[model samples]
Target chain A: MLENKDLLGIKNLSPFEILSIIHTAEKMKLRINNKKLRENTLENYNMVTLFYENSTRTKMSFTMAGKYTGARVTDLGVATSSVNKGESLVDTGVTLDQMGFDIMVIRHSMTGTANLLARNVNASVINAGDGINEHPTQALLDLFTIYEKKKNFKDLKVAIIGDIAHSRVARSNIFGLKKLGAEVVVCGPATLIDKNIECLGAKVTTDLKEALKDADVVMGLRIQLERQKGGLFPDLREYSQIFGVNKDLMKYAKEDAILLHPGPVNRGVELSTDIIDGEQSLINEQVKNGVAVRMAIIDLLIERRKKDEVTNTKWSASESFIQDRWEKRYTG
Target chain B: MAAAKGGFTTICCMPNTNPVVDNEILVEYIKMKAEREAVVNVLPIGSITKGQKGEELSNIGLMAQAGICAISEDGKSVENAGLLKKAMKYASMFNLPVFSHCEDMSLVGGGVMNAGEMAQRIGMKGISADSEEVIVARDIILARSTGVKLHICHISTEGSVQLIREAKLRGEKVTAEVCPHHFSLTDEAVEGYDANTKMNPPLRAKKDVESIKKALKDNIIEIIATDHAPHHIDEKNCEYDKAAFGIVGLETALALGITHLVEEDIISPLELIEKMSTNPAKLLGIDKGSLEVGKVADITIVDPNEEYLIDANSFVSKSKNTPFNGHKVKGKVKYTIVAGKIVVDNGELMD
Candidate 1:
């Protein structure tokens, strides 16, 4: 029972909360696979996807999740909505809330837009993605896929390679994995690596091949071309030669190691396209789990919001109990 | 009223106001209003470029004659070097110090916070230390040639401090100020995406914060002006990138100086006053910032031992935008007196 109404980032989520979401997602995935309709827990609830930035994967998945749960879903097209007429995010959120929306799922290029919008609305705000900040649902889905394979976080080694400075995926994964008693290795060039990232309980290395050694999971992040011009790294050819994952580099990892990427994959850039399509690849599985993970988050948030309304408190009793246990384990 | 309530006897108002303080008329209007309504003296800063558009020079000579103390393109840099060089030359003739908000627009394109790990973590655009250093270097070069009394505003980065230090060593007639927020806070403050933490030359990295503190101690930075910008609720209560680039500072300036500098043993108590008061008054050529026997009796008696949580709702300014709102701080202004009149008594404004 997670207390938070908004799933802004894994950094804010407890390990218990992480497990809670993963377990719920597992059930959702099993039901969906068996051709069972999702429980109509969200009937009469309305959800609006307010995307200030373009995204096909996240938007569609969230919409499908809402519709799957028997909720009314609306997509506010950024180009055509009143948002294009210079409406602030808070104004847009307030307007949607006033129109009786029970939840607003937002994706904005500006970091912290979800949290800012959350403060202004009565509805539960879910972050689809914000600038280079956290994408909680994406992290959750990735976590679900990893937990399915590894079964536990104890003694697990997760290596995240490429664009660590600019990848929201890398940040959330590093925070989430570290909290669950796993060792996270963040590998990138010196410029591409964030300074003091090791302080977040991750080991940072410039040598990707060395970092991949004995790792249980390897996650590759897309390198935006604009970052190259900023001199974070050399041209594409040099980046692929240095940091890109290939068949030769796969020999360094564990025999049963899984590869993960939050894509549309940058073929031959972050990874050789063959690896992305290989047996070791969990990229497609990650995508499939995205729907179930989103469904779990939507369900949890809606449940928590309804419970809090009845209790007239920020968090209900059972939520506070699990939150305390998770927090104590995390800190001590 | 806000300045006096914050224990400031005099303030050099920046040029980037609603209708920018460009010409003589606006300068006169500011002087008239301050005289009529303000509890403290207000020195209007005329824009270096007309409308602060960085084009031709504003009416610097005329505005200076109308008692404008300084010429500044405060928020926006005078990007055109030739135009700025000419403005510096003209400003020099009137002995009006040019306060530069040093920034390269190209380098700062759409950046919202200090370019560091925190910005990387949050996924916001980073304004690099080079952004401020580049302009500091350019303006120092210009000031070297033009011989204007150049004052750099809200100096944040270590590189900018080094630039000003070397410039001062060469006696290039350059002086700089550090905001309390810059020396005390870092890019880490932006972790929560609080818009109150957002300001122009945004809160810098830890190294930069350390450098700013060191610079102030060594007198490389002469003053600690707030660059106190006030914005309405709507302007700041938005996304990190969309919020206005400023924080209200006058109210918190003295406490921050005492807390971070004096209490931390980085600088002595008298040095804090020199940076906050004595030197600022001297640089502006004002008859304030002192309480000599025959002086105007403008003074602020601070408790220095009082500790309180900073609540923005208690701010005398109409705007409640401040990152320090919940910060526990020492040193409260017990009373503020100006021209032998107590404007702020016992931490409350005198009606």
Candidate 2:
């Protein structure tokens, strides 16, 4: 049993809590894949997405699972809303909290803004995205994907490839995979990758082929094009040549190894079109698992927080369940 | 040290800390510490930027009221151009001299020691002498424009010495300090990678060392600051690459000055007092570092002829990270009088 706290970033979690989230995410992902609804554990919980930034995939995927698990969802996408230009994010977080929102999912452009809101807002604030900082749920799904597909963390070599500098995906994956005992290697050009990851206890290299060579899982990093104005990379095409992991680079992986990408893939830039659509890629499973994992997180945080999960003798699986009481019409 | 207010004194502080002071809570911490631990009147040097992260400027009105000696971005240069000019204007309102670290970190990024033939031998990264001169030249011009009292710290190279000399010749309100290591020890001292030999604006080439000596001798330079950086032993007991730079200098400074300048004929002992005590106090607008009556009797008593090996175990600082650990040196601080209290007496600190 873990305390129900909004996990907006890795800084929000103690080492044990991260491991607990990953373990819970693993169980939820396994049961979903096995089609054995052990007990609709999460019931009658509501998680709101108060996204100031547009998020089509994350909103849709999490919404599906929220329905499956009997939770009400409120979404504010850019097309139907007026938040982009005028509203201050701090005011938006306060308004959502005032509206009896259980947990608010927020995405913003400022780094550390989510954590800042989490301090002020009464609701458990989940960071959907914060400019170049971290996306915890993505990292959770990333860990869950590896846990399910690889089955044994100690036996995996996950290589994070592409846009090593601008990708928060690689940063999150490095922390996620390393914690799970997967031998992780980050490979890209010097300009694209983080220079001080060695400080984080991860080996960083510029030779892409050398890193992909014995990888059990090759995760492609995304080139966030908007980061050009932020001066993250000098040029896109120049970035693709020196470090991009194309199909030829994919041949270096283990025979049973899988390819992974937290998408909006760059096609031929970071990953070859064949490799992204290839037999080895688990890109779709990653998106699918993101829902179950986030649901598990919301259930644990919102519903279970009031239930005293940490001090409870046992998790009761039923006392804090959100899946059983979730409205059937929401799912249908 | 004098009991309440009597005797000769030397040196001033430049405040640059972990959570640099810009508000009352911060300056008051320094004030409280100075009141309790310091015998002399403690004058806090408020940072130009609040928290001194070099982004936002601080309110000089509140800082001037806090009894700050001057305004500075002490250990780091004011990297921003427009902000610095504005800071100069604010500091001018309170008449605070803007002190600076003067090194451009981007240019001096990998600088591990003083760049010269010796750095080439030791295989350590060196901060080139040009790094200091270039920034000094820029600040001199900025001072001319903003007319801020620009002070250069730990001036080490011949190029910088000549520049400051020329700037003074042109009558710019620019003053500079040379460290004992800069004039006394050359780049050769870092050959064995004695971490004590390591410093920011690192050490210099022998010719550069001679130039700094000449500057100090000719009064082309105004002060001899120890740049008294203190650190713990755990920070220095490793490879030169690993050990933290900066010697625990507060207690060892006068000894080094006595040995290097007094004996070497580069500077007389009285000239040492004027530069270390009088000139710095006047420059920073501090009223305590002197021996005149009605002055806060903050004074240092010295046995200028005493000879001893530099040992760090006797130092009063919480940190043992000093480069002058085992060098032989002459003279010692016999007593340090703060205001009127005998803070240090007969080489023993009096509580």
Docking class for model 2 is incorrect
DockQ of each: 0.35, 0.01
Name the weakest run of 10 consecutive residues (lDDT summed) in model 1 chain B.
B116-125
**What level of docking quality does candidate 1 show?**
acceptable
Model 2, range A1-332, lDDT digits (tens) per residue?
Answer: 45535566653455566667767776666656766664555455556786656677877777766665666787866455555565645566667778877677877654445654565466777877765556778887887777777766775887887666545566666666666567878887675554556544467777887888888988888777765554656777877787677778778888888888888788888887888888998998888889778877776775556665355633223322211122111233
Model 1, B202-243: lDDT tens digits are 999888899888898899998999989888867776777888
Model 2 segments beyond 4 Å from truth? A11-43, A76-94, A226-234, A309-332, B1-149, B152-280, B284-291, B294-351
Clash pairs detected, candidate 1: none
DockQ of 2: 0.01
- Name the candidate that leads on TM-score: 1
Worst 10 residues of 1 chain A by lDDT: A321-330
Which lDDT value does model 1 have at A257? 98
Kindly state the number of residue pairs that clash in model 1. Answer: 0
